[model samples]
Target: MQLDSGAVAEGRVTRVTDFGAFIQFDNGETGLVHISQIAHSFVRNIHDHVHEGDTVDVKVLGRDERGRLDLSIKELLEEPEEIPRPRAIGRQSPQFEAKLRSFMRDAKERTTAGGKKPTTPTKRKK
Candidate 1:
């Protein structure tokens, strides 16, 4: 089958290079998938996403001036699902609540004993 421009099909990753991967289709037509086109996100290392002999669905981005097919793995694949990031349980340190609880207890005890405000240690700088 002729690998026409704008066609999307499954291909096998014949080889991977620092720049891109060479995808050889079932019809023996080969194309290069540029690193930027490999994924929607930044691809620091191509091996992190694709390896040799791996099957990938690719989109034909048409031929260059020399007639070599330009392919994009990102275009053919479904958009990656956005993963939820970890959010802070509260707006303070993990031990903040514990420290505040202890301070409150100490203040209450001090008030009952002498009705005086709790004094915090002060740093002396020369």
Candidate 2:
């Protein structure tokens, strides 16, 4: 059977390596599923996901520069929902605003004064 980009196929994991796993279809076509393509989340170890002789469904991402088929198991799995980031401090709380105002007032007072702006302490010669 001819496989094209984006085609989904079931294959057996023939070998596992540090970087990826090799899968062989029934028709004798073999492809590689890279570690990054094995899951939606970070994959620290490819062995944790697939082992030799395991059957997995993978999508054909495309061919590599070497003309080997590049596959992805992540494409067949549902993507994880994005987690919302925390709101910025200035926008989130009145306490933060009050602190910012106090800091700015202090800075303005220090600057308007005849004293020079605060400077880092100098090192003394031994």
Candidate 3:
């Protein structure tokens, strides 16, 4: 049977991989559910959610440029967010943000550890 975009159907999970799952329908049509599309939340492991021979509901996203069936499971479960998360005021970084936070904490500790004052130098005789 020909698959149409936005069509919902059930299929057997024929193959499961780290990146995605291959599902084969009774009509012999197969589609891919990319790892990111496998769940509403982050999907670190595809095997945790599905395995080979399991039946699953999928929605046809559309044929890609190569004509392969692009499917989704998470989209059917909920609507996507309308707005993206905001970044830091002046920077966008994962590593830098973490490192910056650590550095700031250490600097604060050093500043607050004040305990002594430096002695002034003596004046020389003319």
Q: Which numbered prediction scores highest in lDDT against the true structure? A: 2
In candidate 1, clashing pairs total 0
lDDT of 2 by residue, 9-109 (tens): 99999999999999999999899999989988778788899999999999999998888999999989888797335455556588888999999999898
* Position 123, candidate 3: lDDT: 100
The clash count of every prediction, one per candidate, is 0, 0, 0
Cα lDDT over the full model 3: 0.87
Q: Write the per-residue lDDT of candidate 3 for residues 12-125, one digit (tens) a residue.
A: 999999999999998998889999898776777899999999999999999999888999998788755753354547756989889999999998777666644545799999
Give candidate 2's error at residue 29 in angstroms: 1.2
Winner by TM-score? 2
Question: What residue runs in model 3 are displaced by over 4 Å at the alpha carbon?
Answer: 79-126
Minimum summed lDDT over a 10-residue window in model 2 is located at 83-92
Q: Compared to the true structure, candidate 1 yields what TM-score?
A: 0.61
The Cα local distance difference test for each model comes to: 0.88, 0.90, 0.87
- The 10-residue segment of model 1 with minimum total lDDT is 82-91
> Candidate 2 at 33: error in angstroms?
0.3
